[model samples]
Every structure is written in structure tokens, then in C-alpha cells.
Target: MRERYEFEGKRFLVLGLAKSGYAAADLLHSLGADVVVNDSSPETGSKEVTALREKGITVICGGHPENILDKGFDTIVKNPGIPYHNPVLKQAVQKGIPIWTEVELSYLISEAPIIAITGSNGKTTTTTLLYHILNIGGKQPLIAGNIGTVACTVAQNAKPDEVIVMEVSSFQLAGTESFRPKIAVWTNLYDAHLDYHGTSEEYALAKAKVTDNQTEEDFFIYNADQHEMLPYIERSAAMKIPFSLQGKKAEGISADDEMIYWQGEPFVKRSIIKLLGQHNLENILAATASAILMDCDKETIENVLSSFTGVRHRMQFVKELKGRTFYNDSKATNTLATKSALSSFQSPVVLIAGGLDRGHSFEELRPYMGRVKAVLALGETAERLVDFAATCGVPLAVKVRSMEEAVQEAYGVSVEGDQILLSPACASWDQYPNFEERGDAFIEAVIKL
Candidate 1:
């Protein structure tokens, strides 16, 4: 078992009963901390809540208490998804109570070195690929964080010889203070999560925090092509390593369309790569760099690259119905990601898009609209996207009320050799809880057809 950090008498307020919060609350309570777990839901009799109560930990549900700020907490471990606009969090800020994400708490207790991957996109794909490569290379590897598993939950069980590969998000990175990775892979940056961070600069700053506490002993693998990330790269104390599809030279890692070079030698041939698209190429390059840095052999890296299918809901193929191919890219909740998905194929696409409006225009996606045969828009921004699609020279644009309607409309217009893509250039919040749920619905609908 990993050694526990001292929390014997510290008071902690876990401000959500999500996976991270539940794990953190449990860990802190086990270490003899005065833990208070709170959630807005009225699941007072829930298993986790009841267990915490049995251990003498406080469980507050039904609603957030008005006096939560006065509870005298030494620190507030918030679930990353919770916004700063929450009344309790705002009050805690006013009271000067320290706020932390479970990532920070995990760092305090983890004995294993961490390879943390963060960016506006490709974090999950790169993290999973690195984990696979490391495992194949004979390194004891465990994957967690942001891909459904909580950080602290994995930390408690981590062995010293293990490598914890984590998919970190901007939300999770923003709340971390002293959480540093031994190897940090920042895939690429883009304008995303503006609703939470409020600005592109703030969003980038949050991602840069993954390397904030890293030292010279650490490695920072980043996109050499992301000129905007140069400022953050200059600020990092870690040894800088660059990965690029443009063939920028790094001592151990560099790549072109043909092959990836390690120490000036061809490591992995690009011809065998299973995942298509330039964005996925970037992900593979970053993952290959991190794997090599961890001493993974060329064979392992090449094997994983050749066999790795792709991450779910991100350009995932559904089924071919009546000579039309359907792709579920519901994870493309932003214009940049959706654009990447659109660029993957040469065939004209019957595009199903739109969702919760994040106050951003779809103007940037206009260029990719040339490849779209028709647009079946849905969600809060459905009507607005139709106008944008029309302006982009798309002849057919329909505003539908739901995903099923969008799919049905797209199928009517699609023909042999035309692809149907559900790459919403907006979030799923207006219709579904998350991209996964939205993607599942699209898959189910396609299967029925």
C-alpha cells in the first residue's frame, strides 16, 4: 500500500459526491481526517453517504447549507466539474479557504511517478495510448483520472514501481496547486471550456498548471506546432521535448507523415497507424514520445500504434446502413475537434451537429463545410447552425429537435459513398448529460436502422 499523507486532524470539505469527491472523502476519513461530504442531491441514504456516516464523517445532502463557508474547513476538495459560481464555493473563496481538486490530494499520497496528459483535445486518446505502450514495454502501468476513474482512488492502491498515466482536463488542472507530473504531455491547445474559464488565456493557463510544479528532473512533451503554447513552454522548469507532424527536431522524438524518428532513426512507420486524421497523428506522436521517454522499445510503440483503434465517441464508426457509413463523434463538443473529425474523410458527409450554445460562432468551421453534403442540426444551437451552414454554401440544412430526428433527416439525404457524421460542434448539455450519452444514443439509433 502507498504511504498515507498526514490528515489526522485536518478538516476537509468535499464539495460534491461525484467519483472524485467520494474517493477523496473516503481516503481522508480513513486517514483520520474530519471529513465533511456534501452534495446537492437528496441521496442521503445512498451507499457512499451511509458509509461515510458510519465512519463518523459528515454527509450533507438534499441541498447545500447556507452556512457551509462557516464550517471551518482547512481545505475544500471540490469536484472539478463544479463551477466557481456555486454559492458555497464563492463563499469559501471569500473566506480564504484553500480549494483543491482531487488531483492534488492524489499527488500527496501517490508513490508512483505520474505521466499526466492535458490539453483542449486528445488528452484521453494520448493517455490511453501511452498506458498501452508502457504496459507492452513491461512497465507496470495503471490508468485513471478524467476517463471515469478518480485520481485519489488509484493513488491509494498505486505501487512504487507503477506508472500512473492520467488524462487530465483543464477543469481538473485549474484546481491543482502542487500537483506535478514526472512526465507531462500537453498535446495541443485550443479555445475550449470558455464558459468555465471565461477566456482563452485563462483556459490555457489552467492547462499550463500541469507543469507549474514540475522541475528540471521532469519531462515536458508538447506540440512544437502550437505557437501559442510557446509562452507556457518557456515558463516550464522541466526539460522541454517537442513532438510535431511538421518534423521539428527533438533529440529523441520527431515525426513527418512517413515515420516517427527517435534519436534520428525511424521508430514507427506511419503506414501502419490505425487511427486516421492529422489530430490523431499528433496524438500518436505525443504518445510515442512519452512512451520512448519512459524507455519503451520501438516494437511496443509500433505495435500499439498499429493496433489501437481509437477512443470511443471521438470519430467512432457506428454501422453502415444502406451503403451509408455513420460516425459518432459526439466528443467533438467544440468547433476545433469537430473540424478535425470532418477533415478525416474525403467523402461528402451528411453532418449531424449542434448542441448547447457556448456563445461561440460556427464561423471557423465554415471552411470544412465544403466537405459536408448536408447539415442536420439539433440542440440549443440547431437553428443558428442552419444559418451558418447555409452561409458556408451548404444547400441542405435542417433544424431538428433531437438526435434521432437529426439521424433520420441525414439518412434521407445520404446515399452510397456519403458518410453520416455526428460530430456536434457544441456540447451535449442541452439534450444529454454528456458526450458519451449522446454518442450512445446516436449508435443505438443507427443500430435500429
Candidate 2:
């Protein structure tokens, strides 16, 4: 296990008691700091709270108490999901106690250098691909952050020789103060998480924070196609390396339909890559730029490109049943992502879309409707999408109640050489906890067929 950072006699208040919060609280307690963990949930018997209590750490449950300030906390390690308007956080700010995310603690403790990646989409695929390339190139890489594992927990157990490759989210980045990575990547930006972030400008600002702490020696890899990010990129101290799919560039990475160009030279042929879609091409280019900048050889990069199938639930190939292929792009939780998925295919697709309605319209997706042979929409936006499909002049539009029903509907209309795609343009919160669960359900239903 990696050694804990210094915190002897320091008083820390940990808010939210979720995975990241518990990990931070536990770390602080282990380092001889006076730690108090608070959760709005009353279930003190929950595994995490119980474990902390077993460690002789203080636990406050049911509600956030006002007396937390009386405890004289030197720092407040907050769960990234918790809003700034939360009473405990507001009080902490009023009292002048510095609030930080668990990532900050992790960065302070980790001896390993980091490669942090963030964007509205494609973060997981890019991060996983980079991990594969780094491993093949002999870099001992550890994956963490929004992909699943808690960043601090990974950091606390990480060895100095390992390279921590984290898929960071805007939520995590918003809480960071000094969490600098040796290499920072912004895949691309789009208007997303507006419900949580309040505005697109705020969301973009949070993503930009990934490179805020970088120095002249660090590298910033980002999408040149997203001119919206240029202002923030210009302000960064790190050397900027941009990736694009539109045209060949003099510096950084870019790709056409045939070859991926790195610094204006042919890096890899598109025929060698196993993953599909224009979005996946962008992801590959981003990963390629990062790996090349990190000194990974061409042979290793090519091997990974040829072999790596893809991350689960994002353009994952399910099966070819009765001569029709199926793809699960459940991670396409926004209109832009769904459009990217749709634009990737030249042939007509029986598109299965819809999920929790996030107040965004289906109007932006109209242009891509020509490629969709039929529409099997489900979840909260089913009927609305069906109505929108009617306006798009889609040949067939059916509103289904469940994923199984949608899959069956798509199968019924599909013919030989056609594609059935599960590229929901909304979140999975209405039907499942996350997109993976929803995607798993779709895969399971397909297997049953």
C-alpha cells in the first residue's frame, strides 16, 4: 500500500459519506488526523459508515449538523456530487475552511505521475485505450476517477513507478484546487450536465480546470475542432497539443477516412482499428496523441489499435443475429453523441433511442434521421421521440415500454444487412441507475433472442 500524506493532529470534516467521502475520511483517520464523517442518510450501519466507526473515527448520520463548525475542522473534504449550496458547505465557506474534492487529497499523496482525461463524452473509451497503449509500452498504468474506482483510494495504494490514468469528470474537476496531472486531455466539449452545473459556460469552465494547475513542463492535449475551448487552452501553462478529424494539421493529431496523421505524418491506417464510428476515430486520435507524446512506440500503439475491442456500453458490438448486426451505444446520453453514432453508419439502422428526458429536444437529431430505417424509442421520451420521428419522415416509428420490447420491435422490422443500434440520446435514470445497467439489459435481451 502507498503511504498516507501528512495530517497528524489536523482536524477534517468529511461531507456526503459516499465512496469518495468515506475513502478520504478513512485516509485522514489513518494519518492520525481528527476526522468527522457526516451523511444525510440515517443508515449508520451502512458498510462504509460502520467501517469508519470500527476504525474509531467519529460518524454523524441522519443530517448535517450545524455544530460541525464547532469541531474546528481545518479542512472539509467534500463529495464531488454535493452542491455548493449545501448547508454544510455554505457554513464551511462562511467559516473560511477550505473545501476540496477527494482528488486533491489523492494528488497530494500519490507519488505516481498522472494522465487525467475529461470531456462531455468519450472519456472512458479514451482513458481505457490509453491504459492499454501505456501497458503495451511498458508503463505501469492505474485507472481511476469517474470510470469507477475512487481516485484517492487508488492513490493511497499506488506505487511510485505506476502511472495513474484517471477519467475525470467536470464534477470532480470542479472541486479540485491543486490536482495537477503531468498530462491533461480534454476530448471535446459540448453542452451537458446543465441540470447540475446550471449553465453551459459553467460546465465548460469546470472542464477547463483540468489543466489549470499545469506548469510549462506539463502537456495539454485537447480537441482542435472545439473552438469554444480555445480561450481556456490559451490560458493554460502547459504545451498544447490538439487533435482533429476534419483535416491534416501541422502539429498534434488528425485523421481522415484513410490514415491518422500525427504532426502531419501518417501515424496509422484506419483499416487497422477494430472500433467503429467517427466518434471512435476522434477517441483513437486523442489516445494516439497522448501515447505518442508519452514516448510510446508505433508498434505498441498499432497492436492496441488492432486488438482493443472497446469499452462496454459505448458502441459495443453485441451480435449478428439473422444477418443483422447490433451495437450498444447506450453511453450516448446526449443528442450530439447520438448524432455522432448515427453519422458513423452509412447503411440504414433500426435505431432504438430514448431514456430519461433531460428537457432537451429531439430537433437537433432530425438531420441524422435519414439513416434510421425504423425507430424503436423507449423510456420517458418514447412518445415524444416517436412524434419527432414522424416529423423527420422516418419510415417506421414505434414507442415501446421496455428495452426488451424495443429490441423485439427493432428485430421485427430489421432485414438482412441492416443494423440495430441502441444509441439512447438521453440518460438512463428513469429505467436504470446508469447507462451500463441499461446497456447490459439490452445485451441480455439480445442473447435471449
User: How does each model score on TM-score?
Assistant: 0.94, 0.97
Instruction: Name the top TM-score candidate.
Output: 2
Error of 1 at 27 (Å): 0.3
Q: RMSD for all candidates, in order, please.
A: 1.9, 1.4
Candidate 1, 174-272: lDDT as tens digits: 898899899998999887767788889999999999899999999999988889999998999999888877673646577786888875777777899
The candidate maximizing lDDT is: 2
lDDT of each: 0.88, 0.90
What TM-score does candidate 2 reach?
A: 0.97
lDDT of 2 by residue, 41-97 (tens): 888469888798899999888998877788788999888898888888888889899
Model 2, poorest ten-residue lDDT window?
Answer: 1-10
Q: Cα lDDT for residue 242, model 2?
A: 89
Model 2 Cα displacement at 267 (Å)? 1.3
